[model samples]
Target: MSDSVFVGIDVSSQTLEVASSSELKTWQVANDAAGLDALVSRLLELGPALTVLEATGGYEFEAACALQAAGLAVAVVNPRTARDFARAMGALAKTDALDAKMLAAFARVLHQHPERERFVKPLADAELQRLQALVLRRRQLVQMITSERQRMRISHVAARPSIERVIEFLKTELGDSEADVAAHVQRHHAELAAALASVPGIGAASVAVLLAELPELGRLDRRRVAALVGVAPLNRDSGQMRGQRSIWGGRADVRRTLYMATLTAVRHNPILKTHYERLLAAGKRKKVALVACMRKLLTMLNAIAKNGSKWDPSLHNA
Candidate 1:
């Protein structure tokens, strides 16, 4: 057994393919404890230097947790990135063995350091997960209700009593879920939540999104937190194109929440509002000014979290 082998596993609903040192192994086991244990033992024997895996929803989370518990270095990369690489390498035809091989080779060539995966820590409290789940479920239910209502309005026949009953139930569920989120926020993040809520234009829903999505907001530095939320302006330039700065990928939920918050901040938050107005006076586009406000708000939130203080207009002006 090599002391530093690189192992890659292609995980699916009912089975997994393991590859290491250019050798492939297949396993057909239930997505349960026993199956995961067997796979872990086999990989441990190889003493892998790193394990590269892809997100398979909740199915692979347990296996990844098991591997981590056994003191293995594991990193889960975006599945789309992995699949794109597979296609690039001409492994376009999908199969468990082929994916495993592609993943192994991907690991060998890309060699992503495990540190990249260390950023998102698992939720330690069951309550945090429950709160997040409720919030997500509520959002899903709201979208469903909206679509149903649109359908009902368009086709009178579709406005059946059954549809109304489901809509009513969804409304009740959303209310209950929202209440749960509020209670969780008060219990776990009282001061931070209050500080966020006190800001003009920010509301309970946006605060909940921030608490749930950007868990590292308070822990990280201002610039780092802004970038994490995808509000940090990034330069776009090529030899001569020299495009304007723009925001890019990060937590979508945080970015969505910030978008609304930024609109409000430009209108109310004294410092941000003045800065936004100045940009408008300088002939900046409204959208451009608004995005700048979003970055400013994120930076301010990080500072507020770090300092354990509320938003102070005077200090902001200084």
Candidate 2:
């Protein structure tokens, strides 16, 4: 096991910096089809035990997926996690080569972690990948519309026409993106989407986000799923001082969508509403209580997905 190799790849729009833990060797390749194939072939020869890369927005997705497809054990971790590991190891310098080397060390540690399997899973398939792209495009269009609307509020009367034109265009694009998302879900994940939508607060948008961004929602246990979505609270205790427990790292995009859905759930979903009110009655703050509701709602959804069941008021409430 000590003789096993570990790899790290620092991915960018133009290049990928590669490193190995077994030696002082490091290399770079273009971030294109040819580069990815060459990197895969080289790693196949090395046969690393694990490969780690930071999630640099969308840049790392292709490299990670390509490596995974080549039968490599790839872990696409959050950038914050990798940075924190580097800081802990006293590797504070930042460069593509240095980052790659740090990631190689991080990969070795992560390979032995108790929760390692959580990071080392298959990337989304082609269908889910397409759905994810559409989902992200919808988000971008919504942002553009929002920005245009805000600009309209501050723009002079003469500039209003241009802002309005941009807003209209963005809205049209948003609608088309939404339609694409719906069609993709209906074609590929109708059953799962229908089951999730059975929950009162979970609308089509939320369902699409979950199916695209959180492929592990149903496969993981309640605790794992909650933690993965950043709803699970963590202890902030010290040697003699017990501090507040707060949620930490997880999928931010998923958490945002879940939080929005939870707000609606607390208002309309009977079970969630009751649970939320109960927490408030117990003297929890509004935000705290709301977070609790998010965790509960997530766990409920997790159970529904795991059991292939729809939301049943009688059973769920019980």
**Winner by TM-score:** 2
Residue 47, model 2: Cα distance from true site in angstroms: 1.3
Model 1: residues with Cα > 4 Å off, grouped in runs: 1-3, 21-29, 87-91, 105-125, 157-165
Q: How many backbone clashes does candidate 1 have?
A: 0
Predicted candidate 1 versus true structure: per-residue lDDT over 1-318, tens digit per residue: 233477778888777777786354644555678889898888888777767777787567777778888998776767887898899998879987777777777776555434342223342246666667767876787799898787667766646776788888889988888888888888988988888777777789888887776777778777777776777889999997989788887678778889988887777777888999999999999988888888878877777777788878777677
Backbone clashes, each candidate: 0, 0
Worst 10-residue lDDT window for candidate 2 reads 115-124
Best by lDDT: 2
lDDT of model 1 at residue 60? 72
- What TM-score would you give candidate 1 relative to the actual structure? 0.83
Residue 118, model 2, lDDT: 50
* Poorest stretch of ten by lDDT in candidate 1: 115-124
Q: Write the per-residue lDDT of candidate 2 for residues 199-290, one digit (tens) a residue.
A: 99999999999999889988889988888878999998989999999997778889999999999999999999999999989999999999
